[model samples]
Target: MERWKKRNWGWKFADHLSELYVVALLLGVAGASFAAALPLASRWYPPQYQGLAMGIAGAGNSGTVLTTLFANRIAQHYGDWHIVFGLALIPVLVTFILFSILAKDSLNQPAPQKFIHYMNVLKQRDAWLFCIFYSVTFGGFVGMSSYLTIFFNAQYGLDPVRAADFTTICVIAGSFFRPVGGWLADKFGGIRMLIMLYSVVAIMMALLSSLPSLTIATSLLFVAMMSLGMGNGSVFQLVPQRFQKEIGVVTGIVGAAGGLGGYFLPKILGNIKLATGSFTFGFLILSGIAILCMLLITIVQRQWRRTWIGASGKARAEHV
Candidate 1:
């Protein structure tokens, strides 16, 4: 590290035009690694435990809390934000070693199929539905996580630190509820839970478009995050149920849909702000989409019940 600093290598890396390409490559690798966990989680846990298991695993998203809570402080303390990136390598390395040692494949792992066969999931209507559903839930959670600080600063006149504080509060609310969502879905029904959640999210977003007071906005956002978080759990709970055999491939595809959704949300907000000088349109647009998602799910309800739901109105503990 000292040698690189002495050689001015850090500046070289930071200034090089091609660094964006390198960063993008590395990000893709990281994304693949993260998505791999979903399929493994399906194999390790039975159908009934899918929600709780995935929720607990997904709670790793709370890593956002750590970054939000400390990134600025670390930069201030060290006088170089880049140094925190170096420090982060320590935890990443440690986690990799622990995962390699502790993680085990399930005995009943899905049999290997031809590589091209995984692509066949594209033929299924349910696959697209799940992808869109996840795109809304996980995508909205991530999008909000990315934009809340900006939103707070713009709407409430908060400084960056205070904005981050508020953002962290929302992030934590969402993260904490992820497992709770899954557990509730396990006890209740994932689809039913999601219908209720999406309806609430639509209502909240519509109300938020009115540009309420700071206190009211914060409360509304907190509830909104909680609902989205739980929606995420519910979506995954149904995925494994519907695509037990193709869980791995479906997870990768759906996860990518979620990423695309997250990418678009901030852009939509930015566009609305630019065109209309207010973010009200963005919230209204999201509210309309939420309503559309509810209707889509409702349309599929009868088919899902006949095909997947058991006599208990819940997913069977075993895959059909």
Candidate 2:
């Protein structure tokens, strides 16, 4: 009887959501796990350390690799991307087997309250700011991660090997620095961290705008990339603090914006490179965006001060 009931329940659960969540879960794990591990495995020496630069710039690029390698390979072998989906099902099958026995969601009930309060977050202007900030931060990380190597090859005249080497170095610096950026945001102030990081990015990008000698350009690029990566984490850290109760809405909107930013940033840079026979405009455009970010933060700073005052005024009046 127990076994029969279990089969019926499992069938219901699977029938409801089917494979969409499973595929997303697998893709997320595979992409993030590989990006984290790939840099750790590769060997880096001085000339070879250039790969590290490429890696740093393009660490998020592991997703493309996973898809191109596994998905494409499966497609070629079996004549469809659908085959890869089936291949992904194996892990889901195994997970289901384990979870069916070992794990269970608590059915505990909570007293109902005003569900309408959840909608209050929609009124917060900072939510829009957080979304924009994340768009630039995470967007820059993933965008540069995929394109940095190609950029180096185009801008610095490095061969494929050297381009990839620099990417590795750059991505390593950015990938790990992200979490640190968020920590600074938590301990210091998120807005303050954003101001500082955006300023750093602006200054560095300004210096980079000229597309100077390769040595200066490469060095400046590295610094700018580092700032962008940190900004990515800092923005996200602030997002949760500001939208604690509306996690799904905040995360979804911000994450989507970041993805869109990533999608377009490279194309913009690549187009600039293609049109002018150099990456000068690309550098200049990024620098300009950095400046815009700085300006936006300045505006937000005033709003933040007003908010603190209003909150404090309310508290004091209540005490009286």
lDDT of 1 by residue, 98-167 (tens): 9999888788787899988988999989999988998999899989988888999998899877888889
Per-residue CA lDDT of model 2 for 48-97, tens digit only, reads: 12123323433444334344235545666676555666676686588569
Clashes of 1: 0
Scored by CA lDDT, what does every candidate get? 0.84, 0.59
Q: Model 1 TM-score?
A: 0.92
State the displacement of the C-alpha of residue 91, model 2, in Å, after optimal TM-score superposition: 11
TM-score to true structure, per model: 0.92, 0.62
- Which 10-residue window in model 2 sums to the lowest lDDT? 309-318
* Candidate 1, position 43, lDDT: 84
